[model samples]
Each structure stands twice: as C-alpha cells, then as structure tokens.
Target: MTTATMSKPSVGFEKLSMRGVTRSYAKAAAPALSHLDLELARGEFVALLGPSGCGKSTALACMAGLQPLTSGSIWRDDVRLDTLPPEKRGFGMVFQNYALFPHMSVQKNVEFGLSMRRVPKAQRHERALRALKMVQLEEHAGKLPSQLSGGQQQRVAIARALAIDPEIVLMDEPLSNLDAALRIEMRTEIKRLYQERGLTVLYVTHDQEEALSLATRLVVLRKGVLEQTGTPQEVYTNPASAYVAGFMGYRNLFPAKVENTGPGDDISVVAHGTVLHGTSRAASGTANGAAVSVAIRPEDLVVAGQSTGNSIKAMAEVVEYHGRELSVQARTGPDTVLHLKTNEPVVAGAVLHLGVVPDRVLVYPADDGEETVQPHV
Candidate 1:
C-alpha cells in the first residue's frame, strides 16, 4: 500500500521539549536519567543511543509517561505534558518485544487502543485496517500474533502503534528482537515510514550502527548522562569525547601526552614513546605535557606504504578474513593493541607498518574521566 493513501496522524508540533528530566530509583547511587534536556521539532527523528543501563530506555519511558520523573518537566509546545496521563499524551509506543495479545487477531490488536478510547466500531476497524496497510500487514490482519513470523509480528506491533494516531511515536529498541537481516529490513521500513508520514519519532537503542542508519539526529548517553547530541554524521565522524569515541567505533585508544600544538586543531602527542599527530577534538586544544586520549577507528588505520605520517610499527597478532578486507589486531607496545582493517593479506606474527591521517585521529582530554588505553576488541 502506498503512503499517499494512508491516513496521517495529527502529530504536527513546534516542539516537544524535555527540560531537566531526571528519574531515580530507590537505593540506586545515581539517577537513571539526569537533567536531560532534549527537544524534538515537528517530524524529527531522534535516536536515544547508549549502552545498557545508560538510561536511554528510561528517558523514553519518562517521556511516554510510563515512568514519573523525579524532577523536571516535559512540554509539548505551550502545553505541559508531564502532568497528563499516558493516554492523554497522544504518544504511541512500540516495545522491544512485540507486546501483542496471543489470543487476539492482528486487526484486533491494532484496534485495542482505539477501542479503549471508545471510538465507534466501524471507524476503529477502518483505522485499524489503514494502520495494518501502512506496515504492509493488512493481509495478515485476521491471523493471530502466534501464527506470524518474528518480522511479521513486529510489523503488527508497529501497525498497532500507528492505529492510535499518536502525536509522537516512542520506540524502545523496536528491532532488537529480530535477526540481523530482518533488523536491516525493518530499519529501512521504519525510515520510510518516518519520511513518508513525516513522523515525530523518539527511538531508543544501544546499537550505534542502527541509530546512525535510522536517526536524523542522535542523542548519546553514558551512565545516565546525556553525552552528546548531533547529526549522525557529526557524532560518527567527530565524537565529542573519548567515551563517545569509544562508543562510535574507535577500536584503538592510546594514552598520550601532548608534545606540541600545531596549526588549526592539529597537535602532536607522545604515545608509546612514539610521536603521533592527530586533530584535537577538545574545545581548547591541549597544551604541551597534558595527558590525553588519542582515538582512531579501525578503518582509518591503513597499512603504511612510504610517507611515514603517524606510522606505527607493529606485529600482527590476529588476522580474520572479511571477504573484501582483513581485520587485523596488531601489537605496537608491551600492553597496547591496535585494530585495523586492510585489503592486504596479513598473516599472524607479520610485522606491519600502520598509518593514520591526522584528521582521522581524534584527541580528547584524559581528564574527561573515561579514557581507556586498551583496544575495544
């Protein structure tokens, strides 16, 4: 079914803002969410990304009214939304699990919310069918959730959320239950829905790649604190901190001391008794002798040919075939390991010279309190 024919939800809003949103559990040392200030403009797709227990899910729950905030407020334009009940918030939520009734047919599951609101039978049925059609699940409307494949069940869950005609869709790891292939397919489907319907989405997930692929903007969290907010490209290419760099797939992190500050955010650092040059991500560039963490992604670390720019001489420890490229883990120091991808066939124990461009190496202050010298697998 074409999106043009599908029913549009009344989701337009100037902004939905979360101001100083904080949630805490009893006996917990820290709040699940801490002074999180976030905003969603009309039709914005924002992904809440972090590791487990980082409170990405908690943030979504607080916004959805499933969890009451310990402090702060939620606003939908001029209206204060935190005081309202979940049903009155006009937000639809898709869960990590399908969350469908085993005994109910797909159509019935989709119509449940409308029925609770006392919509007339015929109108609710029509809306249910339209929502099902939006997810391309109209043909399975009569089948029970138990009789469907995992992907089909997830589609039904999505249809159920849409049937409510919500002002915003709150999804908490909606595709985590599916297989890798299904997750990719559903990611595309969700992206299409957001674009075609101009959806206001607040999605939560721990997978950086999933968030990067689907979100227009990303909100990264660490230990329940909002770490950074930016476009996917901004967060991926230039992470704000060492913690963010680690999460964004910087497999190699080195403890370095600033050697000299060069022109235009370029600086040299002494890491493992070797001088390496990189771009400083810190707002105020590092000074000489200041401790810092240097981060580089595996793909950015290439086999050195001749130029001698930021080159590291290492012995390959492990080599894994990845079809088009090889994944190599190499040891550069007594306790330092670096991971890199290369097209060249590298044998274990082979000596290799790996180099990285200055722009690709990100430098963050070690005092960020999250620096790790070890390679991240």
Candidate 2:
C-alpha cells in the first residue's frame, strides 16, 4: 500500500486494445488463451492476475507478439499490432528471469535497443545512463550481470526496457526472482517509475496480494477467461462471482438456501441449520427458495461480547497466533467449520458466539453448491 501516485495521462482515447484474443496449441485440446477483450487507457497500471495455466502469460505473449494468437486482434491507438513483429511493437518487456546478456556490461545491455535502432552512440550512451539512474543503478552500469544481485539484475532489465522510452511496459512476474523484501522494494520502484514516466503497464503475476497492492485496475482471469476487471477496491470489496470472492480472500464460503426475500435487497440464508441474515451480493433475480453460496472473510467474523442479530454459536477447535490477530478455527455445527480472526486468543474447546454485520455478508450463485475456483495444488 506504499504505492506512489501518478497524474493521469492527458491522452483520452484507448492506448491499447486487445479484441477476441485466443491462442490454441497444436497438441492441446483447449486454447491457452480464450477470447478476451481488454482496453488500457493512456496511463494506467493494469495487472493480469490468475493462477498458473490460467493464460495470463499467454495473454501477455499475444500482446507482445511473442506468441501468435489463434484468433484475435491487437491495436495500439489506430495501428494494428498483430500484423507487426515483436520488435516492431515498440513495447518494453521485462521478463521473469531478468533476461540480461551475460557477456555485456549493464550499460551495454541497456543500450542494446538504441543500438538496434541505429541511434547515435552519444545519444544511446546518454539515454542508457538516464534509464539506469531512474532505477538507481547508474553506479553499477559498468558491472557484469553475474556480479549483481537478483534485485540489481532486475533493475538492469527494467532499465534496458525503459531505455527505448517505450510507451508501455510489459512485465511478466519481474520480481518473482527476488526475495520477499527485495520483491517489495522492486514493486515500489516499479510503481514509482510508472508514475514518474507516465507509462502504461500490463503486469502479469499469480500473486493476488501483489496485484491488489500495485495495480490501478486488476483483470482477474480464470481458466483463460476474464472473470472480472475493476479497481482494486471495487474487486476486493464487491466481487462479481463466487470464484472472484474466493480469489479476493474470502475463506468461509458455504452452501445456503435463500429463505426470505422482499422488495428490498435484504435476505436470509440458512446453511446447516445456521441462519445468516444479510444483504444479498447476488443479482436482482435472487429469490426466495433459491440456492446460493454465502461468503464471509475470516477477519469479518468476530467474537461478540453479546449475541446480536445474525449470530452463531461455535466451538473453538484450534487457535493460531498471527501476531496482531488470532486465527481461530471454530466449528459452527456438526459439519460446518468457520475461520475467525480475533484480537485476543481463545482456548481450544471453548464455546464462542460469533457475529457478522448484514452489510459484510456476500451471496453468490453456487456451482453445484460450491465455489468453482479451486485452491492451487
């Protein structure tokens, strides 16, 4: 959440658009990337987030022209990018492996793009130095790739990408190689660079926390399809589907039946004899007697001083200390287990009353009474 802010770009029209993009391999039964349509405004950091094999990388490859699409079109302003080669797309790409040339010095690696374009030697040298300085690696420009740490190597790769003064930067898990602390450092640096340079970026990563922290807009992908696209707050606070709810950190989801509905959005759902009252996160078509899945975050379910409306009796089965908060696994009924986060720890086997606010409850259409998004193996 320490991300720096950038002024919105002045240009109004869409800077990049991908329409009906699908990529299928010869031996595969299914497409790596299915039909997907996306638009990026002039200056926005958009994260393509999903699990592995969900086609985030394939989407990036299609956009970068590294992988051909089975059926789709890519556009930059008015030009069709699908017809052009990868180099002709004029996009700066930072790879996961920090694709630096082993034989070249950091300075030369960054200047490679300029040399490719036949830029003047003085201009290439000057621009490379500027890029290196932007990433705070100018002093290390003379060093070889093997001499630098993983974070520094990533900086060099970023500097190389930025040396061309690209309009958009495509990063594929650029910080995955670094340790946790260094990842955070590089994430802040990337955000800073985007803001300072006013560049549009499409960052691909499987880490939901990373996407939530860095992107201005998040494009959630599931099985090669676009599940949802919105600002971080919107997507996290108001997920459009059960799959999205699970992805957004909702851990306690269970099957329930809508028992009561009115002209207002308020409804009651019953799961394993536990009745929960809340505003529906479902569409207007949700009606009484309809089966639905109810979702609540572990942090939202709290121990109540007294039983309030929408309260349930649970027995603490296990408690874990998470520093600031205690993660309590409690059994609500014979078969229903709920996870709760509390400030104070509770002893195992203690009976506890838990409560949830009506506004905090989320309801969704269940796929056979369960969320379709499975936990990664």
Instruction: Output the number of the TM-score-best candidate.
Output: 1
RMSD of each: 2.6, 3.5
1-377 per-residue lDDT for model 1 (tens digits) = 45425556664578999999999999999899999999999888999987788899999989989999999999999999999999889888898788899999999999999998899999899999988876678998899999999878888888888787776899998887777786787788788878876789999988888899999999988878888999999999888988888888897877899999998998999885578998998889678999988898999988875537688888899999999999999998789898999998789998888888888888888855653322223
How do all models score by TM-score? 0.91, 0.88
Pairs clashing within candidate 1: none
Model 1 error, position 376 (Å):
10
Model 2, 1-377: lDDT tens digits are 23323233345346799999999999988888889999999888999987788899999989999898899899998999999999998888998788789999999999999899899999899889887886678899899999999888987898898788777889999888778886787788777778787889999987788888889999999878898999999998998888888778877877889888755768888874668887677667587788888888888998987677787788899998888988999997778898889996588998888899987888877655433563321
Q: What is the C-alpha lDDT of each candidate?
A: 0.86, 0.84
Task: Flag regions of model 2 displaced more than 4 Å.
Answer: 1-14, 133-140, 147-151, 333-335, 368-371, 374-377
The list of candidate 1 runs beyond 4 A from truth reads 1-4, 133-140, 146-152, 367-377
Best by lDDT: 1
Compute the lDDT of residue 342 as modeled in candidate 2: 95
* Candidate 2 clash pair list: none
